[model samples]
Target: MPAATSTAEAAGPTAERAPHTGPIRWIVVGSLLTGLLLAAVLSLVVFAGAPEHVITGSALLGFAAGWALLAVLSAWMTSQPQRWAWVPTAGLAATGLGLLVVAPGDGGLTAAGWVWPPALLTMAVWIGVRIRRALAAGSGRWLLYPVVVVIAASAVGGAVETVGLASDDPGRAMPGEVYDVGSYRLHLNCTGSGGPTVVLFNGLGLTSANWARVVPGVARSARVCAYDRAGQGWSEDAPQPRDGNQAAADLHALLQRAGEEGPYVLVGHSIGGDHAMIYAARYPEQVAGMVLLDATDPYRVGGGPPSAMAVLPSLARLGVGRLPPTSYWSTLPEPAAGQVRMFNANPRGWRNVRDEIATLPALLTQARDLTTLGDMPLVVLTAAGAEDDPARLAGQERMAALSTNSSHRPADAGHGALLDEERGAASSVQAVQDVVQAVRAGTPLL
Candidate 1:
């Protein structure tokens, strides 16, 4: 009887402890889930309303809050406390605080890239080791494992992107001359040698590298120059409010500084067409001819909400943009294709996209200033199926009507394909050549 009693007493403590441990494990799981939800909500709420400079930091702080929650809850409820959670909590809090206090802008965020990735990786590794030792075989470690893995993945991705940024040198990859266009520099790669130089203007988010296929075809007959506008490709960034007028002014300064004489044939694709029109309007005597390749109508309206501008840059800085494959630029030939891929992956480039989109409404409004092109030799090449949209077709016709010597031609290709695909690019090449020929002959287009 005494032996049985002794055994019962020995089992009593473990039996009582089992209930507490089981509930605590479940509570830890619940805490993790709740923390994740809180993190998401806080990030969204902060990003929606916070100032542009503080949005990234606020988002990071939200994540830190989640980790802090885990630390507090585990220590308060569980017998085997996850005190190690404080490490990540403290690290994230410090980083977020630094970003907020410094207000470092894009340059600061870029420099921070070199610091955070390895730091995060080390923190994650330490957390994993602590987790293995602190948590028993089946006590809520599974819940925390996924979070650790995600952190590690993010760290690795950031490292890869940092390395890519370090290696990508625009001067070495692109054959161009960088000229000081006022305060900032612009990259211009001009090829061939002839009268009436064809200055190529890229579409939204495009650079000189995108003109690889079109430039070669046009350079066969006339001098073709393609340039990266401020904050794109190899060019240095300029101030904000980068509207059409600003872009035109920059182009004017760039050409004059580079000694690329005027009375030039302007070849603009997509939004570049709108920029060309603005340029022609601003400097009537300098523009000899124009070729619009699936150009965006200056009158067109609609863009993403303004808040997206704040979120996009932050996401890009975190290496979210590089998660996708570089296959999008595969249609472009080697070297150029590689160059495009590298630039697109850059966080600064994404910020440029944000700034451009933010001012698009103003840009479109400014484009309305161009009322006519008079007798300028102009070709408006519309992509296939563009005519399906009545409004779009009308806009194209209107642009064509601006010039007395203009012709509206339909290319059998998609808008982007007009420059990306060989067949479509050939059609674009022909349009530029036709305008060039007309300009030289001083006659109407055929």
Candidate 2:
């Protein structure tokens, strides 16, 4: 009878040890979700102002922490342990530490791209297979599927972006000459032939290709030059903290080296207007006339949230930016359109955007130093909705007041459409033509 009782006790223990079927499964799931939530909160609150690499590394570490939680909690509390979670935990932790220690810049990140994508894909596949084998068929298994999907998708996107980056050869594809502007090279595409050369300055985060619609029209009447700023399009990356002063200095060097002489008719759109104003302020003698197309107000303050800016480069590196369709660039013509899409997808360009935006407050402040353009022919083209915003209209009026010979014309298009759309480009082209004619005739805009 005692031996029978002992056998029954041993069988009871085995029965209790069956796969977790109750509240503990949900607790295990909650652990991973909580880890992810904590990571997100920390990223936005604690690391938002940190450098790009640090922010990226911290995010990886956050993900690793989530996996670590899954490994520990599932093993400790549940009958069906997710021992495979340790694989991702270890991999992510090691990668995060490496990023923190190496602090690799853009080039290093690009090089690492060739390795990490395949490794990530293999790891994700292994994890998925392990989960399928270990987890029972139910809600718990289904709950984990989203995590696997996200990791696998990230791997695929990274692979696609890596291949795209590898194939893009800006030097070979450039339509114009690349001139060494002191520290870095700038791409300058010039067409047509006439004096008081028209130099098109791109808006914030834009490449010369954005001028596809307006350039052809302006080039017909006078020589028009469109060039990429440092760290944009075909231009090589420059040192960071690229303010308006640095931009103006780079342009000056580019023109001097390329022998594209300019008492330039500066055609600037959006933030490009701020850049043009800075250049005119610095070297008033070199500017013959000006056209401000829905230009950004230099006195305006604030921009994108610092937290969003911090994570942008890392997200871009993972190819999140390319998930959106190519339709955004559809308004641009071929070759130019393709070029814009390619460069826009590149992580380097996104980093440049972040850097430029970081210093935009200072750049705008610097532009305010330009109090007057004397009698220079200036045409300020305000976007359609300016009248709806009192402050914006006031800013436009102030810019027009900079030159005694200036004319402020309200356009029928939106801010970007002023140069991107046909009707708006026509308006921009006419403004440029009017300014050119005035410069040549030595008369005011009629």
Candidate 3:
């Protein structure tokens, strides 16, 4: 009796661990239905005022069929590691044909938006499931890393493609400017005022156009210019780097090239915040003050040694641009579509942005340690409603104190909050104004 009881106990754990059943199947099916419904609704909004004859029920049916075909193909091909290469190669070919043959017509199929969405979704979910299965089967550690690499590359390429298309499109530009500053074009938009210059830097995967909402208000009091960095928006590619020191040099050159006056104040967002740090460190004489908006910490963030995939961005090219299943990892609730699409065929400009940003981890860490701009005043703004991670805020405070001539503290603002809510935006703008005032008054603002 005792032996039988022991045997039953030994087998209990195995019995409890069962394979996924009907509920899991239902969940996947439901998600598919949800995606289909969402796609149909979005199509309706896009084709709303078009001739009823044009956006007929049959059009929706065609779209559904197209999505189904894409999903099936993506699921099958993404399983093979080597097939990942074809995704980007195909994307580039499609993009080339798009740029040469098809332009973005009023409502016609353009290269930028033509081949994404379905491709991205089909790819991401498929890759994710692959990863999950590998983990379940306790796959070899070596094989898992390579799989991750392919996914990240696809993500970055997809982002770059998305941003490229948006920036190149003629209708998308501001009335006064045609260039996005991320590339080397030096498309600086300076305020009319002759006061000290306030030069702003954008974060990863973003163009200078991101500062549009803040520029108008800041320009009212002083000269504020925002331009995209190289390989971002409409800016030219980088000869050096989009890192801190390089970014600072770019800003200085732009001031000289554009014939804008300076003794500039630097304002940066996310990775741009790190760039600001480097600029101050390298050229303290040029910077009047700095405001870091949720900058990445070189020491703790990717500045340190990254995974094998992060090191070889090309490896990422091979992954089916799938993202983490939830928003736990990234700020975006929805993963950018370009990541999953075949890189060459994706018309979205986002892939380029992702690719450029991923390679900057080591450079960003180097940027953070630069402290020559210490004489300048500093204000670090962190997001309030962000994940309650003390390490993040503490790191900012530590960096700020180290960089400052005097005190260290937090500015009362949230990450990207300035653009969203009334109070948040007001606070962000006010913080900039305060720095300007301090600089103008010749006071120690840090």
Candidate 4:
């Protein structure tokens, strides 16, 4: 009886500690979950309403579903916050950091770019403090939990960055003609039947399909061709560097090989203007007229690649090759929307974009010396909304001055005005048709 009583006394303190320890465990679990939820919310903010593109309803739903699943897991693993829940908590933190890097610079605070890092770091510090205090008090050793959490988070992030979600259906080629340009196979789509072939060049990081909205209208008057550059759309990556000169060379080769005879009216958007200019300069006889659509000026694009461009390959390594459900697609119709989705899924697209950005400085430098058009009919279509900047308008004016017979038409549209849902594309089509008419008539183009 004395032995039994002594044993009961020895177990009394441990029994009492159980209630006290339970509350502390719950507190730790709560803190971990709060950190994770905060991280996830910040990520959502970064991806949603990003300045680069509009976040689609489906993407938002996917984000919510991803968060909800994590939340449920966090709740279920409350008892094992240190052992089980920390992995996801660290994952949330890593993903938030990745979002900070991927979020467009123009997004500012709305992107939650400024908020996430500090919040996540603070949480990590807080966790460390708790672990240190617990150890000092001789309560328990909690160091392994935080470390494991961090390692697990990094692993998941690395996996995501490396293996990322590739589309099950990746190879949906655009409806077009594929040409073997020796170095690469370039995809070209054409419509209508007439003289002075209208060739369309997509803006930076965009595919030939970007002109889908405007092609039908232009095809009514002239044969219009929109071709994807190497490593874009249905085209394969090229051994040559992605440069304006290379692009111009590829276009010339494709035209010659495909038996698409020209005297062509070249239409270029954004950076494509540089390539069109190069094409006209290199093969003067082949180009009859030129159309510059909200194009980038060689002088205006700053020296060196953008900081974001440098970070893209790193993000790709982190398994985020593409961010889909872009806002631009919302403006497009059904078949076009579906095509954009497939384009978004292509991992090579980002690699190609990176290469283009890397070579922009060199391309712009090369463009500084492109031969003048002399008297070739030229039309410069400036987006009214984008031309609000005096400097931008000045650049557009300068482009119009490239030819003795040139006209600058201000369209009621934004930078990507051709893709605008309303009359933006129609305005551009009219400009192209007018240029074609002027070139054929040998009349002065205002």
How close is each model in CA RMSD to the real structure? 3.0, 2.9, 15.9, 11.6
TM-scores for all candidates: the values are: 0.89, 0.93, 0.53, 0.65
Candidate topping lDDT? 2
Q: 3 or 4, which is superior by lDDT?
A: 4
Could you tell me the TM-score of candidate 2?
0.93
lDDT of 4 by residue, 203-241 (tens): 787887777788888899889998888878778778655
Q: How much does candidate 1 score in TM-score?
A: 0.89
- Model 2: weakest 10-residue lDDT segment is 16-25
* Runs of candidate 4 exceeding 4 Å displacement: 1-173, 301-303, 313-330
Better of 1 and 4 by TM-score: 1
Best by TM-score: 2
lDDT of 3 by residue, 39-145 (tens): 35533454332221223222334334433433444344333122332443344344434433443321243232334544654555565555465323322224334
Candidate 3 has what TM-score?
Answer: 0.53
> What is residue 133's positional error in candidate 3, in angstroms?
33
Candidate 1's C-alpha lDDT? 0.81
Assess each prediction's global lDDT (C-alpha) against the native: 0.81, 0.84, 0.53, 0.65
lDDT of 2 at 180: 89
Off by over 4 Å in 3: 1-168, 175-184, 239-241, 303-348, 385-387, 403-413
